[model samples]
Target: MKSLSLHFISIGGSVMHNLAIALQQQGHKVTGSDDEIYEPSRTRLQKQGLLPAEMGWNPANIHTGLDAVILGMHARKDNPELLKAQELGLAVYSYPEFIYEQSKHKQRVVIAGSHGKTTITSILLHVLNYHKRNFDYLVGAQIEGFDTMVKLTADAPLLIAEGDEYGASPLDTRPKFLFFQPHIALISGIAWDHVNIYPTYDSYVHQFELLADSLPKAGAIVFDDTDDMLDVIALKEREDVTRQPYDVHSYRISNGQTWLKTKSAGDVPVQIFGEHNMKNIAGALAVCDRLGITEEMFYEAIQSFKGAARRLELVTSNDQKTIYRDFAHAPSKVGATTAAVRQQFPNRKLIACVELHTFSSLNKNFLGQYRDKLDQADVAVVFYSPHTLEMKRMEPISPQEIITAFDRPDLQIFTDTASLQTFLESQSTAAPSVYLLMSSGTFGGLDVNRLGEQ
Candidate 1:
């Protein structure tokens, strides 16, 4: 419990920057270095007085007195500070490993899956904050209410984390969630992603099975029964761990508001919509229940929750049209996001555009997985940056390949953002249509909002 000095390698990353600020807030002397720092993170670090003067790693910053050096995945294996830490015999740990060590004495709740982790984590954090509960949290995306993505407190007895299945660090190929060893966990669902690392569906699923097996005997796992893969994994492993299965809770939409109806809890109006979010609500309620929050309190807290940033975020809206931006690139995410918008605005013509930005999404081998994902949209357009393919070291994919992969004869594929912009401008402005832009990356730095305006 004594004060400690911590140095973070590649501290400018979203999660790393927040963790550094969290440590500083907890009275720890935090210093960090990164090759580059971008907006939001750069501003955040400066606000907390944790921004390093220079960009590159400096071995002089690493000293024997440091209690631990937390390495971000962005840092390479041959990072100079990392080598210096090894030479000085200092303790080196991945970000997740360090988080687990800090929360070893607290109850851990991990939200896992290929998607929806951030939404569920944000919901839990909001509800906990509303109830005035002192708890630590680590979420991947920025939330409106929370100042930092990471929080470490001496008094908090609980730790909630958005458990991503991505590798922990360059040296550790194991999934980051493996280190948390949660007392309570939730799997939103299963969908194969990260094809660069997890080459096959079976191989990708094995990670979830391993995560399930890591739970302690008294631990509990809440999973979506809708996903057959998750169901099989839960039933096949860890009989000693309690299993809780949930599906999309009953909900009805009327006059632009979604209402939830639970047997135990009466109908409650919610700010967010979609069947996927309804399922997320059920999972979060189960976790909150484990923490002694009543069903009514959970509903009350969730009623005001807008949503996590970039998960169906509304960019702009006029009387005639609305534009939304979301970080939905995977097949499941694409389907869910498009379906949500269509369901919410049943009267509007939906124009959904998605960018194949990630390594997995851009891979020719994985393209077939996106078949019919954008079918819900009245007009579907898929975009991929040619430069992205080059950067990922992937073979150039043609528009014909993308259209064939989607299995939609009417699908339009564009490699140039400007051409897509022109196509969007040609759409009828008289009709009420929702413009949904889905991507993990900016579409070649194209201003989607500006395009929507035109």
Candidate 2:
């Protein structure tokens, strides 16, 4: 990989900024522009001397001497810089396409699904890092030891990427995973999400089918057999690729601690627990096995894996209660996360609160998918901000509508954050209980660390 000048259209993006930093660290001359830049990305780029002097697109940044111009999903197809690049006949590559260009020689392992992709990818990376293996990766969430979510190196033989099903860029409507062309892939589970793009269920499932079908000859696809959709995909006759099915790993819950049962290592203790996570572990182990990591080595590395940030992350704990914050906005994720907490502490009263924030979760058409998702919690509460709906230009929903959608007459719904926080704080004083706050948003600026102290 020779040093080359590269410019990013929307460098303020989360992954885009990280990629810019990675490229800069690799001795590439990196420059970028974004209409708006937010915290972390802004401060990070400033430190790396990659931050744009001013916001908004500038065609002057484009030059014939540049190697290529990478486009971020945040930038529109008609962006001025993009138009300039096309006018100059410069090579314009979407971030995914550029990533592939850099790692075309490496064996790619992509973890794809509606849920569990982040967890499964994080687990694999943690295990690989634990054994001191040199590998590059692109994960969605921040891991404990990793500095950046995206990493690329010239010499790493493997690239473990979290394959998102969302559209790659404005110019490319295909799912991001399609660009990876993985040698080894894993489908955690398929549940329809991102309603704005994949309007129909069939369309959503088709993206994953394409990924499965895209594998190279003798490639491997590890999937969860428990998912009906994944089951159908895996059953398809394909001699070119290997279909490896995995189920929930053998594990037991003892006094609120989950332990993995292994033949080589007696009952290994792990930091992360949940039925969904057990399945995630099984999928990761299957992929690791393909990567030449033995079961013994995986279990040894998994014991210290705390899990990806915001996926059932522990906020605080005391003598009689524990509080967890999770990024579980989708229907399947909400159900799995709530059930996992319930199963983890069956004896304790579980109070679960979920915020409807994502476009899919707030839409009335998609609300029915959440029916029975929070049933496992002793008290299920839902929070939604009217301002959020207004911002998204979605129809305002009533409490009755949510009640009907979830089919839970006892469900508590709040349209304001203060009221929601009040209810959660009141319940925090109860002894022998667990609190799970699930959301992709900030619950309208409600502070979890303060709420956990109540």
Clashing pairs in 1: none
Tens digit of per-residue lDDT, candidate 2, span 302-378: 99999999999999988777899999999999999999999998888899999999999999999999999999998
Backbone clashes counted, model 2 = 0
lDDT by candidate, in order shown: 0.90, 0.92
Where model 1 places Cα greater than 4 Å from the true spot, the runs are 237-239
- Residue 190 shift from truth in candidate 1, angstroms: 0.7
* Candidate 1 accuracy as TM-score: 0.97
RMSD of each: 1.4, 1.2
lDDT (Cα, 0-100) at 74 in candidate 1: 86
1-454: candidate 1 lDDT, tens digit per residue: 5689999999998899999998888889999999999988999999988889988989999998899999999889999999999999999999899999888999999999998899999999999999999999999998889988999877789999999998999879799999998999899999999999999999999999988888898999999999999989888767589999988989999976799986766888987888899988988988899999998888888988988999888888887878889999999999999999999999899999999999899899999999989999999999898888887789999899999999889998888988888887777578888889999888777777676667
